[model samples]
Target: MPGDALVHRINRIQGQLEALKRIVTSGEADCVKTIELAKAASNAIKKFAQAYVETHLDQCIEEKVAVKELHGEMRKVVHSSFSL
Candidate 1:
């Protein structure tokens, strides 16, 4: 069920990407429209990444830290998830 939800989110992102591609290829998008589309795509990507981190990585880190109080491992998880 969780995987299905994740897949649905990914599909929505893909649709946003396709919309962005259409805007670029249509050649009718003005500067404002282009910027708007780009921003929308960027926001979608950010939301997806944030959801992934919160849903998957956070749970994994919590599980690991609970099993063994590995502060360094938890820090590494946080760094890797948030880092570009």
Candidate 2:
């Protein structure tokens, strides 16, 4: 189970997505603004994923494997996943 902090992040991401949807559906949507909103939502998603990974490493990884190398690899994978 995720903590309160992760819930907060999820709420923020939902809000961003909602805002993006509203702009896209509105009649006077600006292209730049829409792109910005989309980027913000994308960034929020990436941050959510990053935070979840950290939480998983802290709470779940200890039971399954060693943290030394696995932690580094996890971070690398997450970072690369979000990288352009």
Candidate 3:
């Protein structure tokens, strides 16, 4: 059920991104509207990433920590995810 909710959110984000693309390609959206759509899409992506990290990465790290396996690989993964 939670995964289904996440997939639904991801699909919604995809639709938002497609709408933003259409706005850019159609050349009908004004600067303000374009900016608003872009910001919304960006925020959605950030929220999804945050959710993924919280749900998946946190659990993974917790598991590793329990086994004293937290290492450079985990740091690299987190750094790369944020660096984008």
lDDT per residue for candidate 3 within 1-84, as digits (tens), equals: 767767877998999989988988897988998898889888888888777777787677767864445787677777987795
lDDT per residue (tens digit) for residues 9-80 in model 1? 889879878887887889877889778878887887778777777778767666775555667776777798
Question: Candidate 2 lDDT, tens digit per residue, 1-84?
Answer: 578889999999999888888887787789998898899888888889888887886666566487677778778887899688
lDDT of 3 at 7: 85
Worst 10 residues of 1 by lDDT: 61-70
Ranking by lDDT: 2, 3, 1
Off by over 4 Å in 3: 62-69, 81-84
Q: Compute each candidate's TM-score over C-alphas.
A: 0.63, 0.68, 0.75
For model 2, state the Cα shift of residue 11 in Å: 0.5
lDDT-better candidate, 2 vs 3: 2
Evaluated at residue 8, the lDDT of candidate 3 is: 79
Each prediction's total of clashing residue pairs, residues at least 3 apart in sequence or on different chains, is: 0, 0, 0
Give the winner by TM-score.
3
- Candidates 1 and 2 compared: the better one by lDDT is 2
